[model samples]
Target: MTRLLGGIGAQVLAVLAAVGRVAIFAAVTLRHLVTPPFYGREFLGALLNIGWLSLPVVGLTAVFTGGALALQIYAGGSRFDAEAVVPQIVAIGMVRELGPVLVGLMIAARVTSSIAAEIATMKVTEQIDALVTLSTHPMKYLTVPRVLAGLVTVPLLVGVGDIIGIFGGYQVAVRSLGFNPATYLQNTVDFLEPLDVLSSLVKGAAFGVIATLMGCYSGMNSGRGAQGVGAATKSSVEAASVLILAANFLLTGVFFSA
Candidate 1:
Protein backbone atom coordinates (compact mmCIF):
# COMPACT_ATOMS: atom_id res chain seq x y z
CA MET A 1 0.00 0.00 0.00
CA THR A 2 2.83 2.39 0.77
CA ARG A 3 4.57 1.52 -2.48
CA LEU A 4 1.41 2.10 -4.48
CA LEU A 5 0.83 5.45 -2.82
CA GLY A 6 4.41 6.43 -3.52
CA GLY A 7 4.04 5.53 -7.17
CA ILE A 8 0.88 7.57 -7.45
CA GLY A 9 2.53 10.52 -5.80
CA ALA A 10 5.48 10.25 -8.15
CA GLN A 11 3.22 10.23 -11.17
CA VAL A 12 1.30 13.24 -9.94
CA LEU A 13 4.51 15.17 -9.34
CA ALA A 14 5.80 14.28 -12.80
CA VAL A 15 2.59 15.49 -14.38
CA LEU A 16 2.72 18.73 -12.50
CA ALA A 17 6.33 19.21 -13.51
CA ALA A 18 5.45 18.69 -17.13
CA VAL A 19 2.60 21.16 -16.84
CA GLY A 20 4.91 23.75 -15.35
CA ARG A 21 7.50 23.33 -18.07
CA VAL A 22 4.86 23.72 -20.75
CA ALA A 23 3.46 26.81 -19.06
CA ILE A 24 6.88 28.44 -18.99
CA PHE A 25 7.50 27.55 -22.62
CA ALA A 26 4.16 29.04 -23.57
CA ALA A 27 4.87 32.21 -21.66
CA VAL A 28 8.21 32.59 -23.37
CA THR A 29 6.65 31.99 -26.75
CA LEU A 30 4.04 34.65 -26.02
CA ARG A 31 6.79 37.05 -25.12
CA HIS A 32 8.55 36.35 -28.39
CA LEU A 33 5.26 36.86 -30.24
CA VAL A 34 5.06 40.46 -29.09
CA THR A 35 8.76 41.23 -29.36
CA PRO A 36 10.74 42.20 -32.44
CA PRO A 37 13.01 40.10 -34.71
CA PHE A 38 9.93 38.30 -36.00
CA TYR A 39 10.64 35.95 -38.90
CA GLY A 40 8.17 36.43 -41.72
CA ARG A 41 9.55 33.69 -43.93
CA GLU A 42 9.35 31.11 -41.16
CA PHE A 43 5.88 32.29 -40.18
CA LEU A 44 4.66 32.00 -43.78
CA GLY A 45 6.16 28.56 -44.08
CA ALA A 46 4.49 27.51 -40.87
CA LEU A 47 1.17 28.91 -42.10
CA LEU A 48 1.42 26.78 -45.21
CA ASN A 49 2.44 23.67 -43.33
CA ILE A 50 0.10 23.90 -40.38
CA GLY A 51 -2.97 25.51 -41.92
CA TRP A 52 -3.39 24.97 -45.64
CA LEU A 53 -1.78 21.54 -45.62
CA SER A 54 -4.04 20.43 -42.81
CA LEU A 55 -7.34 21.11 -44.56
CA PRO A 56 -7.83 17.91 -46.52
CA VAL A 57 -7.57 15.68 -43.48
CA VAL A 58 -9.74 18.01 -41.43
CA GLY A 59 -12.41 18.08 -44.13
CA LEU A 60 -12.47 14.32 -44.61
CA THR A 61 -12.66 13.65 -40.89
CA ALA A 62 -15.44 16.19 -40.33
CA VAL A 63 -17.59 14.93 -43.20
CA PHE A 64 -17.47 11.30 -42.14
CA THR A 65 -17.98 12.16 -38.49
CA GLY A 66 -20.98 14.31 -39.30
CA GLY A 67 -22.52 11.61 -41.43
CA ALA A 68 -21.99 8.99 -38.76
CA LEU A 69 -23.31 11.30 -36.06
CA ALA A 70 -26.49 11.93 -38.03
CA LEU A 71 -27.05 8.23 -38.58
CA GLN A 72 -26.55 7.42 -34.94
CA ILE A 73 -28.73 10.26 -33.73
CA TYR A 74 -31.50 9.36 -36.15
CA ALA A 75 -31.38 5.69 -35.12
CA GLY A 76 -31.40 6.57 -31.43
CA GLY A 77 -34.08 9.20 -31.79
CA SER A 78 -36.39 6.86 -33.70
CA ARG A 79 -36.81 4.67 -30.64
CA PHE A 80 -38.49 7.53 -28.77
CA ASP A 81 -40.29 9.01 -31.78
CA ALA A 82 -37.93 11.99 -31.65
CA GLU A 83 -36.47 11.46 -35.09
CA ALA A 84 -37.47 14.92 -36.27
CA VAL A 85 -34.89 16.47 -34.00
CA VAL A 86 -32.03 15.12 -36.08
CA PRO A 87 -31.17 18.43 -37.73
CA GLN A 88 -31.08 20.39 -34.52
CA ILE A 89 -29.13 17.71 -32.71
CA VAL A 90 -26.64 17.27 -35.51
CA ALA A 91 -26.17 21.00 -35.77
CA ILE A 92 -25.60 21.38 -32.06
CA GLY A 93 -23.39 18.32 -31.74
CA MET A 94 -21.23 19.17 -34.70
CA VAL A 95 -20.91 22.85 -33.95
CA ARG A 96 -20.57 22.63 -30.21
CA GLU A 97 -18.55 19.43 -29.84
CA LEU A 98 -17.59 17.22 -32.74
CA GLY A 99 -16.25 19.77 -35.21
CA PRO A 100 -13.72 21.43 -32.93
CA VAL A 101 -12.70 18.26 -31.10
CA LEU A 102 -12.26 16.20 -34.22
CA VAL A 103 -10.31 18.88 -35.99
CA GLY A 104 -8.14 19.45 -32.93
CA LEU A 105 -7.41 15.74 -32.58
CA MET A 106 -6.60 15.41 -36.23
CA ILE A 107 -4.23 18.34 -35.94
CA ALA A 108 -2.65 16.73 -32.93
CA ALA A 109 -2.11 13.47 -34.77
CA ARG A 110 -0.73 15.05 -37.92
CA VAL A 111 0.80 18.40 -37.12
CA THR A 112 2.02 17.70 -33.62
CA SER A 113 3.87 14.59 -34.67
CA SER A 114 5.39 16.35 -37.64
CA ILE A 115 6.58 19.33 -35.65
CA ALA A 116 8.03 17.16 -32.92
CA ALA A 117 9.83 14.88 -35.30
CA GLU A 118 11.22 17.70 -37.37
CA ILE A 119 12.42 19.74 -34.45
CA ALA A 120 13.74 16.73 -32.59
CA THR A 121 15.73 15.77 -35.65
CA MET A 122 17.11 19.25 -35.85
CA LYS A 123 18.09 19.07 -32.21
CA VAL A 124 19.79 15.72 -32.72
CA THR A 125 21.79 17.20 -35.58
CA GLU A 126 22.72 20.23 -33.47
CA GLN A 127 20.89 22.62 -35.78
CA ILE A 128 19.20 24.30 -32.84
CA ASP A 129 22.61 24.77 -31.27
CA ALA A 130 23.83 26.19 -34.53
CA LEU A 131 20.96 28.71 -34.46
CA VAL A 132 22.13 29.85 -31.05
CA THR A 133 25.68 30.05 -32.31
CA LEU A 134 24.50 32.42 -35.02
CA SER A 135 22.81 34.72 -32.48
CA THR A 136 19.30 33.58 -33.47
CA HIS A 137 16.84 33.04 -30.67
CA PRO A 138 15.64 29.51 -31.26
CA MET A 139 12.28 30.13 -29.62
CA LYS A 140 11.59 33.17 -31.74
CA TYR A 141 12.77 31.60 -34.99
CA LEU A 142 11.39 28.12 -34.59
CA THR A 143 8.59 28.00 -32.03
CA VAL A 144 6.92 31.35 -32.41
CA PRO A 145 6.04 31.07 -36.08
CA ARG A 146 4.48 27.65 -35.77
CA VAL A 147 2.58 28.62 -32.66
CA LEU A 148 1.27 31.77 -34.28
CA ALA A 149 0.21 29.90 -37.40
CA GLY A 150 -1.65 27.42 -35.25
CA LEU A 151 -3.45 30.19 -33.36
CA VAL A 152 -4.48 31.88 -36.59
CA THR A 153 -5.41 28.87 -38.67
CA VAL A 154 -6.96 26.30 -36.38
CA PRO A 155 -10.08 28.39 -35.78
CA LEU A 156 -10.42 28.77 -39.51
CA LEU A 157 -10.12 25.04 -39.90
CA VAL A 158 -12.74 24.53 -37.23
CA GLY A 159 -15.09 26.91 -39.01
CA VAL A 160 -14.60 25.02 -42.26
CA GLY A 161 -15.06 21.69 -40.53
CA ASP A 162 -18.29 22.85 -38.93
CA ILE A 163 -19.71 23.85 -42.27
CA ILE A 164 -18.62 20.68 -44.02
CA GLY A 165 -19.87 18.56 -41.19
CA ILE A 166 -23.26 20.20 -41.29
CA PHE A 167 -23.39 19.76 -45.05
CA GLY A 168 -22.47 16.11 -44.63
CA GLY A 169 -25.33 15.64 -42.22
CA TYR A 170 -27.57 17.42 -44.70
CA GLN A 171 -26.56 15.00 -47.41
CA VAL A 172 -27.19 11.94 -45.28
CA ALA A 173 -30.48 13.22 -43.90
CA VAL A 174 -31.82 14.20 -47.31
CA ARG A 175 -30.82 11.07 -49.21
CA SER A 176 -30.73 8.27 -46.68
CA LEU A 177 -32.96 9.39 -43.81
CA GLY A 178 -35.73 10.96 -45.93
CA PHE A 179 -35.44 14.37 -44.30
CA ASN A 180 -36.70 17.30 -46.29
CA PRO A 181 -33.66 19.21 -47.40
CA ALA A 182 -35.00 22.70 -46.92
CA THR A 183 -36.54 22.02 -43.53
CA TYR A 184 -33.45 20.20 -42.30
CA LEU A 185 -31.23 23.13 -43.22
CA GLN A 186 -33.69 25.60 -41.75
CA ASN A 187 -33.85 23.70 -38.51
CA THR A 188 -30.10 23.48 -38.28
CA VAL A 189 -29.69 27.17 -38.92
CA ASP A 190 -32.36 28.17 -36.48
CA PHE A 191 -31.11 25.88 -33.74
CA LEU A 192 -27.52 27.08 -33.74
CA GLU A 193 -26.86 30.10 -31.51
CA PRO A 194 -23.99 32.52 -31.88
CA LEU A 195 -22.57 31.25 -28.60
CA ASP A 196 -22.32 27.76 -30.05
CA VAL A 197 -20.15 28.99 -32.90
CA LEU A 198 -18.14 31.19 -30.60
CA SER A 199 -17.46 28.32 -28.28
CA SER A 200 -16.24 26.16 -31.17
CA LEU A 201 -13.83 28.80 -32.42
CA VAL A 202 -12.59 29.40 -28.92
CA LYS A 203 -12.00 25.69 -28.42
CA GLY A 204 -10.16 25.57 -31.70
CA ALA A 205 -7.86 28.36 -30.66
CA ALA A 206 -7.09 26.69 -27.35
CA PHE A 207 -6.50 23.34 -28.99
CA GLY A 208 -4.26 24.93 -31.56
CA VAL A 209 -2.07 26.33 -28.85
CA ILE A 210 -2.01 23.04 -27.01
CA ALA A 211 -1.13 20.97 -30.04
CA THR A 212 1.66 23.20 -31.32
CA LEU A 213 3.03 23.98 -27.89
CA MET A 214 3.27 20.33 -26.95
CA GLY A 215 5.15 19.62 -30.14
CA CYS A 216 7.60 22.44 -29.59
CA TYR A 217 8.08 21.57 -25.94
CA SER A 218 8.69 17.89 -26.57
CA GLY A 219 11.02 18.59 -29.44
CA MET A 220 13.11 21.24 -27.75
CA ASN A 221 13.61 19.05 -24.72
CA SER A 222 14.16 15.76 -26.55
CA GLY A 223 17.10 13.51 -25.86
CA ARG A 224 19.79 12.61 -28.40
CA GLY A 225 19.69 10.61 -31.64
CA ALA A 226 17.01 8.80 -33.66
CA GLN A 227 15.36 7.12 -30.71
CA GLY A 228 14.99 10.46 -29.01
CA VAL A 229 13.32 11.97 -32.03
CA GLY A 230 10.89 9.08 -32.29
CA ALA A 231 10.07 9.26 -28.59
CA ALA A 232 9.53 12.99 -28.75
CA THR A 233 7.21 12.60 -31.70
CA LYS A 234 5.19 9.94 -29.90
CA SER A 235 4.99 11.88 -26.65
CA SER A 236 3.98 15.08 -28.38
CA VAL A 237 1.00 13.41 -30.07
CA GLU A 238 -0.07 11.70 -26.87
CA ALA A 239 0.20 14.87 -24.79
CA ALA A 240 -1.52 17.04 -27.37
CA SER A 241 -4.36 14.55 -27.86
CA VAL A 242 -5.07 14.23 -24.14
CA LEU A 243 -4.81 17.95 -23.52
CA ILE A 244 -7.11 18.75 -26.42
CA LEU A 245 -9.80 16.45 -25.08
CA ALA A 246 -9.47 17.85 -21.57
CA ALA A 247 -9.63 21.40 -22.89
CA ASN A 248 -12.72 20.50 -24.89
CA PHE A 249 -14.56 19.32 -21.80
CA LEU A 250 -13.60 22.41 -19.82
CA LEU A 251 -14.46 24.77 -22.65
CA THR A 252 -17.79 23.06 -23.17
CA GLY A 253 -18.68 23.47 -19.53
CA VAL A 254 -17.63 27.09 -19.57
CA PHE A 255 -19.66 27.85 -22.69
CA PHE A 256 -22.82 25.93 -21.82
CA SER A 257 -23.05 25.56 -18.08
CA ALA A 258 -25.75 27.83 -16.69
Candidate 2:
Protein backbone atom coordinates (compact mmCIF):
# COMPACT_ATOMS: atom_id res chain seq x y z
CA MET A 1 0.00 0.00 0.00
CA THR A 2 2.76 2.46 0.84
CA ARG A 3 4.58 1.65 -2.36
CA LEU A 4 1.43 2.18 -4.43
CA LEU A 5 0.80 5.53 -2.78
CA GLY A 6 4.38 6.57 -3.40
CA GLY A 7 4.11 5.63 -7.04
CA ILE A 8 0.93 7.63 -7.44
CA GLY A 9 2.47 10.69 -5.85
CA ALA A 10 5.54 10.44 -8.05
CA GLN A 11 3.41 10.16 -11.15
CA VAL A 12 1.36 13.21 -10.16
CA LEU A 13 4.53 15.21 -9.56
CA ALA A 14 5.93 14.18 -12.90
CA VAL A 15 2.75 15.24 -14.64
CA LEU A 16 2.86 18.60 -12.92
CA ALA A 17 6.46 19.07 -13.96
CA ALA A 18 5.58 18.27 -17.55
CA VAL A 19 2.79 20.82 -17.42
CA GLY A 20 5.18 23.43 -16.09
CA ARG A 21 7.62 22.76 -18.90
CA VAL A 22 4.87 23.17 -21.45
CA ALA A 23 3.84 26.45 -19.88
CA ILE A 24 7.39 27.74 -20.07
CA PHE A 25 7.66 26.62 -23.70
CA ALA A 26 4.45 28.43 -24.53
CA ALA A 27 5.66 31.60 -22.87
CA VAL A 28 8.89 31.54 -24.78
CA THR A 29 7.09 30.90 -28.04
CA LEU A 30 4.73 33.80 -27.41
CA ARG A 31 7.62 36.08 -26.62
CA HIS A 32 9.24 35.21 -29.91
CA LEU A 33 6.09 36.19 -31.81
CA VAL A 34 6.67 39.93 -31.40
CA THR A 35 10.39 39.76 -32.16
CA PRO A 36 11.73 40.62 -35.58
CA PRO A 37 12.75 38.27 -38.45
CA PHE A 38 9.24 36.91 -38.89
CA TYR A 39 8.90 33.95 -41.24
CA GLY A 40 6.09 34.96 -43.56
CA ARG A 41 6.34 32.01 -45.95
CA GLU A 42 6.38 29.50 -43.17
CA PHE A 43 3.43 31.18 -41.51
CA LEU A 44 1.45 31.08 -44.75
CA GLY A 45 2.32 27.44 -45.28
CA ALA A 46 1.24 26.56 -41.78
CA LEU A 47 -2.01 28.46 -42.27
CA LEU A 48 -2.66 26.45 -45.37
CA ASN A 49 -1.73 23.19 -43.72
CA ILE A 50 -3.48 23.66 -40.41
CA GLY A 51 -6.51 25.59 -41.59
CA TRP A 52 -7.27 25.10 -45.29
CA LEU A 53 -6.22 21.48 -45.46
CA SER A 54 -8.33 20.71 -42.42
CA LEU A 55 -11.59 21.98 -43.90
CA PRO A 56 -12.84 18.81 -45.58
CA VAL A 57 -12.64 16.75 -42.42
CA VAL A 58 -14.15 19.52 -40.34
CA GLY A 59 -17.05 19.91 -42.78
CA LEU A 60 -17.81 16.21 -42.95
CA THR A 61 -17.67 15.83 -39.18
CA ALA A 62 -19.89 18.85 -38.57
CA VAL A 63 -22.50 17.96 -41.15
CA PHE A 64 -22.96 14.39 -40.01
CA THR A 65 -22.98 15.37 -36.34
CA GLY A 66 -25.53 18.10 -36.94
CA GLY A 67 -27.81 15.82 -38.94
CA ALA A 68 -27.64 13.10 -36.32
CA LEU A 69 -28.21 15.60 -33.57
CA ALA A 70 -31.30 16.91 -35.31
CA LEU A 71 -32.69 13.44 -35.61
CA GLN A 72 -32.00 12.62 -31.98
CA ILE A 73 -33.47 15.88 -30.76
CA TYR A 74 -36.50 15.42 -32.93
CA ALA A 75 -37.11 11.92 -31.66
CA GLY A 76 -36.80 13.02 -28.08
CA GLY A 77 -38.93 16.09 -28.64
CA SER A 78 -41.69 14.09 -30.28
CA ARG A 79 -42.11 12.15 -27.07
CA PHE A 80 -42.71 15.47 -25.33
CA ASP A 81 -44.74 16.85 -28.26
CA ALA A 82 -42.18 19.59 -28.70
CA GLU A 83 -40.83 18.60 -32.10
CA ALA A 84 -41.16 22.10 -33.51
CA VAL A 85 -38.38 23.28 -31.22
CA VAL A 86 -35.80 21.33 -33.18
CA PRO A 87 -34.50 24.30 -35.12
CA GLN A 88 -33.79 26.41 -32.05
CA ILE A 89 -32.24 23.48 -30.22
CA VAL A 90 -30.06 22.52 -33.15
CA ALA A 91 -28.86 26.05 -33.69
CA ILE A 92 -27.99 26.63 -30.08
CA GLY A 93 -26.37 23.22 -29.74
CA MET A 94 -24.21 23.59 -32.81
CA VAL A 95 -23.11 27.13 -32.12
CA ARG A 96 -22.61 26.75 -28.40
CA GLU A 97 -20.95 23.36 -27.88
CA LEU A 98 -20.78 20.77 -30.62
CA GLY A 99 -19.22 23.00 -33.25
CA PRO A 100 -16.13 24.05 -31.31
CA VAL A 101 -15.56 20.73 -29.57
CA LEU A 102 -15.79 18.66 -32.74
CA VAL A 103 -13.50 20.97 -34.70
CA GLY A 104 -10.95 21.01 -31.87
CA LEU A 105 -10.87 17.22 -31.57
CA MET A 106 -10.54 16.84 -35.31
CA ILE A 107 -7.59 19.23 -35.27
CA ALA A 108 -6.02 17.33 -32.40
CA ALA A 109 -6.31 14.07 -34.35
CA ARG A 110 -5.07 15.43 -37.65
CA VAL A 111 -2.91 18.49 -37.11
CA THR A 112 -1.37 17.59 -33.78
CA SER A 113 -0.15 14.19 -34.96
CA SER A 114 1.17 15.61 -38.20
CA ILE A 115 3.03 18.44 -36.53
CA ALA A 116 4.58 16.23 -33.87
CA ALA A 117 5.70 13.56 -36.33
CA GLU A 118 7.18 16.06 -38.73
CA ILE A 119 9.05 17.97 -36.09
CA ALA A 120 10.25 14.85 -34.32
CA THR A 121 11.63 13.52 -37.57
CA MET A 122 13.35 16.83 -38.21
CA LYS A 123 14.93 16.67 -34.77
CA VAL A 124 16.08 13.09 -35.30
CA THR A 125 17.69 14.20 -38.57
CA GLU A 126 19.59 16.89 -36.72
CA GLN A 127 17.83 19.63 -38.65
CA ILE A 128 17.08 21.57 -35.49
CA ASP A 129 20.77 21.63 -34.68
CA ALA A 130 21.47 22.74 -38.23
CA LEU A 131 19.10 25.66 -37.72
CA VAL A 132 21.02 26.61 -34.61
CA THR A 133 24.25 26.36 -36.55
CA LEU A 134 22.81 28.70 -39.18
CA SER A 135 22.03 31.20 -36.43
CA THR A 136 18.30 30.71 -36.89
CA HIS A 137 16.27 30.37 -33.74
CA PRO A 138 14.36 27.13 -34.16
CA MET A 139 11.56 28.26 -31.92
CA LYS A 140 10.96 31.41 -33.95
CA TYR A 141 11.40 29.81 -37.33
CA LEU A 142 9.52 26.57 -36.66
CA THR A 143 7.25 26.85 -33.68
CA VAL A 144 6.12 30.46 -33.72
CA PRO A 145 4.66 30.46 -37.19
CA ARG A 146 2.67 27.30 -36.65
CA VAL A 147 1.33 28.46 -33.31
CA LEU A 148 0.40 31.87 -34.68
CA ALA A 149 -1.32 30.42 -37.68
CA GLY A 150 -3.32 28.10 -35.50
CA LEU A 151 -4.33 30.90 -33.14
CA VAL A 152 -5.50 33.06 -36.03
CA THR A 153 -7.17 30.49 -38.25
CA VAL A 154 -8.92 28.08 -35.92
CA PRO A 155 -11.60 30.56 -34.93
CA LEU A 156 -12.36 30.99 -38.59
CA LEU A 157 -12.56 27.22 -38.91
CA VAL A 158 -14.95 27.09 -35.98
CA GLY A 159 -17.16 29.69 -37.59
CA VAL A 160 -17.21 27.74 -40.80
CA GLY A 161 -17.95 24.53 -38.91
CA ASP A 162 -20.83 26.17 -37.10
CA ILE A 163 -22.40 27.31 -40.35
CA ILE A 164 -21.94 23.96 -42.05
CA GLY A 165 -23.38 22.17 -39.07
CA ILE A 166 -26.47 24.38 -38.95
CA PHE A 167 -26.93 23.92 -42.67
CA GLY A 168 -26.75 20.17 -42.29
CA GLY A 169 -29.48 20.25 -39.68
CA TYR A 170 -31.52 22.45 -41.96
CA GLN A 171 -31.16 20.04 -44.86
CA VAL A 172 -32.26 17.07 -42.84
CA ALA A 173 -35.14 18.91 -41.29
CA VAL A 174 -36.47 20.37 -44.52
CA ARG A 175 -35.97 17.28 -46.66
CA SER A 176 -36.71 14.36 -44.41
CA LEU A 177 -38.18 15.69 -41.15
CA GLY A 178 -40.94 17.66 -42.90
CA PHE A 179 -39.84 21.03 -41.57
CA ASN A 180 -40.62 24.13 -43.64
CA PRO A 181 -37.29 25.39 -44.84
CA ALA A 182 -38.05 29.05 -44.39
CA THR A 183 -39.58 28.72 -40.94
CA TYR A 184 -36.83 26.42 -39.75
CA LEU A 185 -34.16 28.91 -40.77
CA GLN A 186 -36.05 31.73 -39.18
CA ASN A 187 -36.40 29.87 -35.91
CA THR A 188 -32.73 29.00 -35.91
CA VAL A 189 -31.75 32.58 -36.53
CA ASP A 190 -34.04 33.91 -33.87
CA PHE A 191 -32.94 31.55 -31.15
CA LEU A 192 -29.18 31.95 -31.24
CA GLU A 193 -27.70 34.85 -29.26
CA PRO A 194 -24.49 36.59 -30.23
CA LEU A 195 -22.87 35.31 -27.05
CA ASP A 196 -23.16 31.72 -28.26
CA VAL A 197 -21.13 32.51 -31.34
CA LEU A 198 -18.63 34.57 -29.38
CA SER A 199 -18.04 31.84 -26.86
CA SER A 200 -17.59 29.30 -29.64
CA LEU A 201 -14.92 31.35 -31.41
CA VAL A 202 -13.18 31.94 -28.10
CA LYS A 203 -13.14 28.23 -27.41
CA GLY A 204 -11.72 27.66 -30.85
CA ALA A 205 -8.80 29.98 -30.19
CA ALA A 206 -8.07 28.32 -26.87
CA PHE A 207 -8.25 24.80 -28.32
CA GLY A 208 -6.09 25.82 -31.26
CA VAL A 209 -3.36 27.09 -28.96
CA ILE A 210 -3.48 23.91 -26.91
CA ALA A 211 -3.32 21.67 -29.97
CA THR A 212 -0.32 23.34 -31.59
CA LEU A 213 1.52 23.93 -28.31
CA MET A 214 1.30 20.26 -27.34
CA GLY A 215 2.57 19.18 -30.73
CA CYS A 216 5.56 21.53 -30.66
CA TYR A 217 6.41 20.78 -27.05
CA SER A 218 6.29 17.04 -27.58
CA GLY A 219 8.34 17.24 -30.74
CA MET A 220 11.02 19.48 -29.25
CA ASN A 221 11.45 17.22 -26.26
CA SER A 222 11.15 13.93 -28.13
CA GLY A 223 13.59 11.08 -27.61
CA ARG A 224 16.34 10.13 -30.05
CA GLY A 225 15.01 7.67 -32.61
CA ALA A 226 12.13 6.11 -34.56
CA GLN A 227 10.42 4.85 -31.43
CA GLY A 228 10.73 8.27 -29.88
CA VAL A 229 9.16 9.98 -32.87
CA GLY A 230 6.26 7.53 -32.78
CA ALA A 231 5.78 8.05 -29.08
CA ALA A 232 5.86 11.82 -29.43
CA THR A 233 3.30 11.77 -32.21
CA LYS A 234 1.00 9.52 -30.22
CA SER A 235 1.36 11.50 -27.03
CA SER A 236 0.77 14.84 -28.76
CA VAL A 237 -2.62 13.81 -30.07
CA GLU A 238 -3.67 12.20 -26.79
CA ALA A 239 -2.65 15.23 -24.73
CA ALA A 240 -4.26 17.73 -27.11
CA SER A 241 -7.54 15.83 -27.20
CA VAL A 242 -7.76 15.50 -23.43
CA LEU A 243 -6.81 19.14 -22.88
CA ILE A 244 -9.35 20.32 -25.44
CA LEU A 245 -12.17 18.51 -23.65
CA ALA A 246 -11.10 19.79 -20.26
CA ALA A 247 -10.82 23.35 -21.56
CA ASN A 248 -14.25 23.06 -23.13
CA PHE A 249 -15.78 22.09 -19.83
CA LEU A 250 -14.09 24.91 -17.97
CA LEU A 251 -14.98 27.49 -20.61
CA THR A 252 -18.57 26.32 -20.71
CA GLY A 253 -18.88 26.64 -17.00
CA VAL A 254 -17.35 30.10 -17.07
CA PHE A 255 -19.54 31.31 -19.90
CA PHE A 256 -22.77 29.79 -18.68
CA SER A 257 -22.57 29.79 -14.93
CA ALA A 258 -24.55 32.70 -13.64
Q: What TM-score do all the candidates reach, one by one?
A: 0.98, 0.99
In order of listing, the candidates' clash counts read 0, 0
Off by over 4 Å in 2: none
Q: Write the per-residue lDDT of candidate 2 for residues 1-258, one digit (tens) a residue.
A: 999999999999999998899889999998999998999999999999999999999999999999998999999999989999989999999999999999999999999999999999999999999999999999999899999998998999999999999999999999999999999999999999988999999999999999998999889989999999999999999999999999999999999887
lDDT of 2: 0.95
Per-residue lDDT, model 2, residue 52, is 99
Which ten contiguous residues of candidate 2 have the minimum total lDDT?
A: 212-221
Superposed Cα deviation of residue 46, candidate 1 (Å): 0.8
Residue 200, model 2, lDDT: 99
Q: How far does residue 244 in candidate 2 sit from its true spot (Å)? A: 0.6
Candidate 2 backbone overlaps, count: 0
Q: Which segments of model 1 are wrong by more than 4 Å?
A: none
lDDT of 1 at 166: 93
